[model samples]
Target: MRETKEINALLHLIDDPDEEVFSTVSERIVSYGKGIIPNLENLWENTPDETTQERIELLIHSLHYRDLKTNLSDWGKLENPELLQGALLIDRYQYPEVSFNGITQELERMRRNIWLELNNYLTPLEQVNIINGILYNYYKLKGTEVAYTNPDEFFLHKVIESKKGNAISTGILYAALCQLLDINVLPVNIPRQFILGYFDPNYDVLHAGGNPAHKIQFFLDPMTGQVFTHKDVETYFKRISVPPIPTYYKPLTPKRTIQLLTEELSKCFGSQPYKQAELAQLSQLLGD
Candidate 1:
């Protein structure tokens, strides 16, 4: 591979101002991961490229092989992709992003800085309380979970088809944030719902959920951020459009939630008013 200095020399040679060096670097930087980050940063600095800077940031993120607290400056060489993926598996849970040997490693890079923000936040709380806090906060800041399906089958299908707002994408972002906080959250598939998550506590009686209705409430030990089965929804999913469905606020088992996301995702591809193939894929994931 070419060294950063050599690449730096080449980057300056792009005669056409309109030519996108960012796109060039996007594809090229993967192999170089950590090594190319400084040059990419330099590229960002020299060029009038707010957008390119973002892309380079993603490149650097995709290439990262360390935890949130670890600085790149202290790093050594990254050996292979497998090791890289193993480093970023986000604890025990696996998703479409973690599907293979070589591909898994490359995909880990795609996760970018998803878990970067989560390092120091989590504490010895029950798992469910943490779930409620995250969902509640996120919903308050960004309304409606940025849902793909609006209960209108036709419109929902169009959004999914257009690759617009999606549950999986949104869920991933949500999960990444939780992970970064050192929050051990897992995606739980709830029936008829696209996806819910869980952060298991010490006792089996201890569980929590993310409700689609109401305040995204479920259960939590407010003090420790731990989740418990018996909790309230009026406090969760605070900025939700609908009123709290107290009847809906209940403990969700991981197995049950998986089934739920799969079924709802299947509807995406089903011949409803808003049929989508993406739903089929998501459904299959849950079933698997």
Candidate 2:
């Protein structure tokens, strides 16, 4: 009650004629962070002044954006930030009101379904096949073939809800499920494509191998869960007239992977005039 009273008092000063006084009041109100959002919102509802209402709206947006930056930084600091959680954090930037628990429940349900269809006796290839069947065949999650203008295709929750995504979003889902099931699949940063490579369980990713490509059992296209061999990757490089780099064959850390998702999302906003602010925020987040 006391906090509400204090917040309301500061909010009343939001429309002060003096720029200095209003700035001081605004800074104090924003310092209270997201906890003050409801109070600001309530003040906006009861207040008749258009200027004060706009100030309140700005304060609310500022708080939400601050919270978003904090959450993303925290995710980066986590020892093992899982793919699903990282992607959801990115999703929250665009959907601050989205329910984290609801997203978790939906993903958990899918993970459980994929889990039930496998066992210790299954070979690596067999495991991949089972997950592929469940994800593409049964669930019908298809890729957006040419979603150059579709930014929503990069959000994992949107992908889950729509059953459609581009390479990175779908790859994150596929890799997350594989990790949960103790499968050794990890995302590899293939140029112009996001893909996964099934690693040998005993292969030391952190240490030396004659070639990093040797660490991969095979590659899978996230769009369709289609498996491919090293020879296929080589063929792709030849087709593109680009030389294959060994680093491209290695797995990306969870942070790097999320960065890729954010980068791709920002590019999609190029043609969206109204989304310029969002693109700028994403670019800043990517820089951090």
Candidate 3:
């Protein structure tokens, strides 16, 4: 930002020894919004003190986080929030400067490739097979169990670039692809697992009153693109000593799915108090 006399004065006081004075100065700098970031960065470069640099870093993070919260709040209000965009917003929490266009363009390329092989005659299972083959075989995307030690796996851009993600990230990627292709795949609220369900196209319009599970043609393990049957899910419920309730089988709305992602991603920040608090706040933005 074009630094005014007041902005220059605030930048000078950022290194103040008094905690109260520094806190007040920091708040005023943040109040200027993200436009003040350039001024902070310039100060950091000329300043020799490590402590002052750290303070400037925190100021920059505060600005980015404030902006992120606003974006996520707006995203949560959408009628049918785009899954990929939601994931990208979560991604910005860690990588504020990362460009999402590359990720979008990459997804578009994959979509075009899948579209070329798709036909109107393909059955639901066949359609899923094509997606599985392209994503797993052609794209070579790998899925691992969720590991909090490796936080990067939860990020959408990192997942795309590394071709590896845990269940949540991979599931989001899968659901996003289906969205682009107009497929009826969605995430289901299976306890302790992130699974996708392939719903019958007419279920929403024709059989909306029945147990939602009855409307699902099959289930998918996002970790491997492997298919599961009703019997399989039923056996899972029995093994876990939980009843297969109607809600468990219902497709999750995009908002809920993104909120789930945010909640899961928050687990990776347990060691960083500021990050954990920030993620908790982000998740609250999507709260019911």
Candidate 4:
């Protein structure tokens, strides 16, 4: 990071016209990792050529992306990784410099508001109602249909900042809140949909061997905070001609949920080949 002779030489060769020379220099620059970003930024500020500036920008992005891959790999290794933390890592893919402390604080505020209304006597449905009332009604968080045209809809920070997100982002937020409150709500592997299931608290202890679907009292659509009964899910399976398998009803682990999020987010980058490849790699890292 200190402007040593080697770093100065690399910075000077950034304008090399030969592709092989530039690629070698770029690799060496990236080898310095994220700590060299400030030096690159200063170089970008003084550089006159737009092409050279673009090259510097790519180098900076490469550094951030390399760091993201390492962090995500570490996150995947966590036995019980926090869902919010996983989602924030994905958010950082697009916004490398953004601070997520504000996002965490905002979530804490929402959690405290819901906690104030919660009591031991409230039914599971009632608890969900309070969450829905506060999040959807009071906080006015909105959910939109998943559309690949807008990449921001896939980011958690953007979702909180704008109060709008697609099904996946909103579902992550919904499940995250449930996690903070120690509720049993979780995302299920429902085909072609992102939905949460409220598990019976005693099911794990009492009937772990039985069909997992029997453990769910109801399903929730994160898009609108609307509840769905078993009958509704059954009808949906019939309409779609997909058998209602027990596995689909089981809760996805936090790591798997983040993997699915990365997979879905990758779709948004189809037009950008390099970006799509990078996202695909990120998703694969989570899977590994």
Best by the lDDT measure: 4
Question: In model 1, which range of ten residues has the least summed lDDT?
Answer: 72-81
* lDDT tens digits by residue: candidate 4, 89-175: 999999998788999999999999999999999999999999999999998999999888899999999999999999999999999
TM-score of each: 0.30, 0.85, 0.97, 0.97
Clashes per model (N, Cα, C within 3 A)? 27, 0, 0, 0
Q: Residue 163, candidate 1: how far off, in angstroms? A: 9.3
Cα RMSD, model 1: 14.9
Cα lDDT, all candidates: 0.38, 0.82, 0.91, 0.92
Across residues 1-288, which tens digit of lDDT does each residue of candidate 3 receive? 998999989999999999999999989999999998989999999999999999999999999999999999999998768888999998998999999889899999999999999999999999999999999999999999988888899999999999999999999999999989999888998898999999887766224787898889999999899999999999999999999999888888777888888788888878888888888888888888
Q: How accurate is candidate 1 locally (lDDT)?
A: 0.38
Stretches of candidate 4 above 4 Å error? 203-208
Off by over 4 Å in 2: 1-6, 13-25, 47-55, 146-148, 270-288
* Candidate that beats the other on lDDT, 1 or 2, i.e. the better one: 2
Q: Give the distance in Å from residue 4's predicted Cα in candidate 1 to where it truly belongs.
A: 54
